[model samples]
Target chain A: MNAALPILALFTLLALALGLYARRGHDMGLEGWAVGGRGFGPILVFLLLAGEIYTTFTFLGASGFSYGSGAPAYYIIAYGALAYVLGYFLLPAVWRVGQANKLVSQPDFFVHQYDSPALGVLVAIVDILALIPYLVLQLTGLGIIVSLASYGAIDKAVAIWIGAVIVTLYIVASGVRGSAWTAVVKDIMILAIVVFLGLYLPYHLYGGIGAMFAKINTAKPGFLVFPASGQSIWWFATTVLLTSLGFFMWPHSLGACFTARSANVFRKNAIALPIYQLILLFVYFVGFAAVLSVPGLKGAATNLALFKIVIAQFPPWFVGLVGAVGILTALVPGSLIAMTAATLTARNLYGLARPDAKDDEIVNVAKAFVPVIMLIAVYFTLSGSSTIVSLLLVGYSFVTQLFPALVASFFPQIGVTKQGAFAGIAAGVLMSAWLTFTGQSVGKLMPFLPQAIKDFNVGIIALALNVIIMVAVSAVTARKALQPARS
Target chain B: MRPVYWIALIPFVGILAGPVLHNHVHPFILGMPFPLGWVSVWLVITAVLMAVLYALDPANAGE
Candidate 1:
């Protein structure tokens, strides 16, 4: 009677075996554990990057957005396609810098560029803080996926523990290489499940997508597109801009940049990634179909729209398999997030703190952080309030604050001083967090400003201020340097 | 003297141009909603644009 135990356990074992096999015969060192020895070709790089970016957020959340809200879901497609374009231009240069510096982690780039080990430590701390929430999101979603698919045959806490233990063990044993290989499996299964559901659900329920939309649009006019005055056109535009900018700034993505054998690998993936995102369009279709067939989903229940439709429409075994795929979606990205957080602590923080720490020692130290990171995430998962989740969610934009400093690092003539970077980052994070918190607390930050710009994400507004501070500080420092000094 | 990087900005702007194009839901294309089609069109164009930008790069020219 129970579908979750057999299906999830089998695939989890298979995935664990595959993950373990991925790192076999590879030497463990800073390079291996952090960047997969920087030897992956274009194809592996594509799968790893794609798998990393398309997590449970893409699988469950996007469709739910479509089911619950309608047209704003298109931002998922808009931001992703846009992000790869940004990535295409920005990442190759990053790869070049990383290669030149022999950088294994994101903070390594920060250290080498800003010429400040202290900055590296700051980056490591900020990166881990930013990542734990994302990891917690994945682990929490995995728990729900396992229990839901099993039809409550397994307890949600049990599912969460199972996912946490497996993810921790495999990531520690295999590192980034293990993460990439498991990604290959996750990607194949996800694409299959998503595509099948996207095509079959619409036709089976509503005869076709055209007919399905005809009913939804008839019932609820303007549900298909964003409103102009309230959200305004700029609202959508700003979110796409802010989130896309935030995309590459993520430490896992930055670390993924160094895994490539060449910078060209990033360029090729940038082009290919959009085509991969077209899959989301199908996911949108699933969400819209859930609206018509499985109506009345509310709040947290909305996220269950896609999976509920699958369980209702498909056989129990297929439902179990879909559940397995969902778990993989969570685990694949969770492993990468955990791996990067560990890598940042080991390579950037520990290595900087103890500069004499050996290569193998750094690698070992990072491996040790693997379980610690997961356990901390699991602890937060168990204990964290909605307020805590909101706190971390606000931090998503704090990572984007690093964009100005990061861009300056690539160009020495930009004159971004170390103090300026520090001041700018602190201001950016503080302002961005303040804006997000106040908005959540008070409902809106500015009622006086024009509806168009005022409706936009606070992160971009904070980012604009961040850029000004960095430039102003840099100009002052630059001018001060040029001025003659008296003894 | 010109920056090819500036040219890449065109595609980025194009990607965000959808919601600002219109406020209503009546207009549809390719048997889908307007925003959906707008994003799909840009998604394809983004791929082509990145490919072109790659070709234009002197660093990648040796290939």
Candidate 2:
């Protein structure tokens, strides 16, 4: 009976309506459904690409990170800026290849470039493994936002179930177009709300942004700067480097790149998107404010810092507005992730298994798999206790395994054979799983190493092993002509 | 690679310079901690450099 619950329900229904409406006038062929018919102009393409940035992860996870870990969260801002620099060059090349080959999914690019359905299947599996955790992060954020905004009237599990169903409904109906249409609304609402809270909170709590940071610095020394070890400078630098290399390696990001009208859209976006990414600084401001105000949000609960602070200060109607934007942030990315995962399953996994299946039939199979993927994500959301940022880093480690082979594909001189790409990805993914499961960092894995070297992001070690295996394997395997080595 | 593309590396180097050059809380830039401010400044520079690169590149010229 909370006013916020009614508002949340209303906006959720609006998201559903917008998503289904997006499917109108467009043929729901595999290409149209998955990549929006490859006709998105600059604005729509910008929303789609930028939409990937300001997700539930950025909405809650980032503020939560700043609240929990302090200065290490600034790596989020650094990695994204550097990633856009890489994307300026990387995405346009991806677009050219995608446009020329009519590639429908990220795995399709690998299949065409390597001429190996087997490698495509392998990539599909890796992408789905990585994507499920990301999807879980969105659902987890949705659950937290809804429950908090409703003043704990709604149960977390119930909120997540409702969110998953709503997302699956639109995604099954409209595919990427559902996400793109909702993204327009999500981006605007997030921008205004984040900036307002970011500026207002610090002033309201501690007079100003500088004053707020000054107070936190005095209270918790070294909280706003990197330490010499552990989550230290070396960790930040290496993490930023590794994640930038892996940024567009996300299947959904590559899928977004392919949705564009031309390669130039990426070139133009490379200019605009970095500026947009700085908005995370505002998000961080809100998080930093919460560290002192909403103290004791530890472990998995840190992701609630932003919303908790907002709920404490704002009335029910305003909290409802924030909750509505929170749901949009999740739904936009959640739908995109679900749609991409389902398409990958259909196009790369099942289609490879059944090579004679028609494109329309594969599209139907993808739609059917939306709910299946959502169910898997929901189960993980209910069970997992990791912080939202940690969940994403796990996904990043898995997908970044793809970065070496992907970059090598753009240049034939690198001569990464399909066999090499396959072996390297397998090795890297296995190493990531080992590291993640064992709860090991490079520091613990190799105790004798210097603090600087030891503190390197654990993913970089897997990447190094991947590159060595790739180069070693390619050295022996016969090189095939690299298709679309136009760059 | 075009020499113009080297402009892209400036942001990477600048932002990653956090641990080395700008990891401080004082002398705040635009009311942010030095590291955060440094990276925020580089974000805008990155956009400008990409804009410059976009203009210089002949690949985008015809379009």
Candidate 2's TM-score reads: 0.98
TM-scores vs. true structure, each candidate: 0.94, 0.98
Q: How does residue A77 of candidate 1 score in lDDT? A: 83
lDDT of 1 by residue, A336-373 (tens): 99999988888887777788988899889988989899
- Model 2's CAPRI class? medium
lDDT of each: 0.79, 0.89
lDDT of 2 by residue, A1-487 (tens): 8789899988889999999999999998899999999999999989988887899999999999999999899888888877887888888888888899889899998888878888899999999999999999999999999999999999999999999998888888888999999898888888999999999999999999999999999999999998878888888999999998888889999999999988888888889999999889889999999989989988988999999999889899899999999999999999999999999999998997799999999999999999999999999999988789989998999999998998888887777888888999999999999998899999898999999899999998899999999889887885453443333
Estimate how well candidate 1 is docked, as a DockQ score: 0.69
The TM-score of the first chain in every model comes to 0.94, 0.98
